[model samples]
Target: MMYQEYVDAITPDQEAGLKRTNGRMLANTILQNPDCFSTSDRASAQTILDSINSGVQQDAVDQLHDDIEECVEDATDEYSWSNC
Candidate 1:
């Protein structure tokens, strides 16, 4: 199959490199032509680049924070110290 041959051609590392390159190119396009995307899309794209530069994706960080908060809340609720 054409798809199978295509898939077999590139190694995992090569695929990852290609994906990163494509993402950078897309980000550059978004920055150079803001009109192509909606306001939220533009903001999201910039946030992605910011997260990449900072060494982690913003969404993953936010989700981690949220998960931690929920865990803390649950633990506190499980050991309530009620006073009269």
Candidate 2:
């Protein structure tokens, strides 16, 4: 089956799991639903999911770092320090 078919076949439970895991559940779903996904498809999905998850994590960390820096800068600045 194509990737879109596999995606469309995902059950409500799997959808919830995907939301909870930030899509990390995709690899596990591919493994569990072997009837829907071929071995090569599973491998490709896992690789893609890993790359996406890694990028998401890095983006989150970058945002947190930026927020922290902004907060610190605000706290140190004489005009904004009081509000911070």
Candidate 3:
């Protein structure tokens, strides 16, 4: 199967796992750095949050694009146009 197909097959499951992992990471960070949520730690927290959010958004977009490609491929295959 193509890489895109693999991504399309795995994305939804991966997303759930990713969310759990992110939740654990946040919990650990809070436990390790109790002050990290304070006004004094705003900069650090903001940086971490931004990075996590960006990564999640990118993953979601990539997965969506992969799924769309797979759907198009399936449609083409149904019509026997998949020569690639």
Candidate 4:
């Protein structure tokens, strides 16, 4: 479901016993979800999101991944995660 994407993404596996959504997963989500970002933002966002997903070969991308992960982890709840 549309909602499950976020729920799965936000909950850290550290506590939920679920797989924490890593950069790769987040990248996949970005690639797969058309509505997650604005049309103007999607192209650039996907590039960075995908870059981080790939084991963060680039330090900048890695930092970006960390930032995004932190933001999501801090901001999300079940309902929001549910509808990512």
Highest lDDT model number: 2
Candidate 2: tens digits of C-alpha lDDT, residues 1-84 = 544554566657665435435444556667668898788978876886777677778878999999999988876786754654
Let me know the TM-score candidate 2 reaches against the reference structure: 0.53
lDDT of 4 by residue, 1-84 (tens): 343564465554453222324433554555677777566556754775665445434656878999999888777754576755
* Residue 79, model 1: Cα distance from true site in angstroms: 52
The parts of candidate 4 lying over 4 Å away from their true place are: 1-21, 53-84
Candidate 2: residue 49 lDDT (0-100) = 78
Cα lDDT tens digits for candidate 3, 1-84: 332343344444577656545544554454456654565455554565676677779989999999999999999888796565
In terms of TM-score, the best-performing candidate is 2
Give per-residue lDDT, candidate 1, residue 49. Answer: 63
TM-score, every prediction: 0.41, 0.53, 0.50, 0.29
RMSD of 4: 18.5
lDDT of each: 0.62, 0.69, 0.61, 0.56
Error of 2 at 41 (Å): 0.5
User: What is residue 49's positional error in candidate 1, in angstroms?
Assistant: 1.1
Higher-scoring candidate on lDDT, 2 or 3? 2
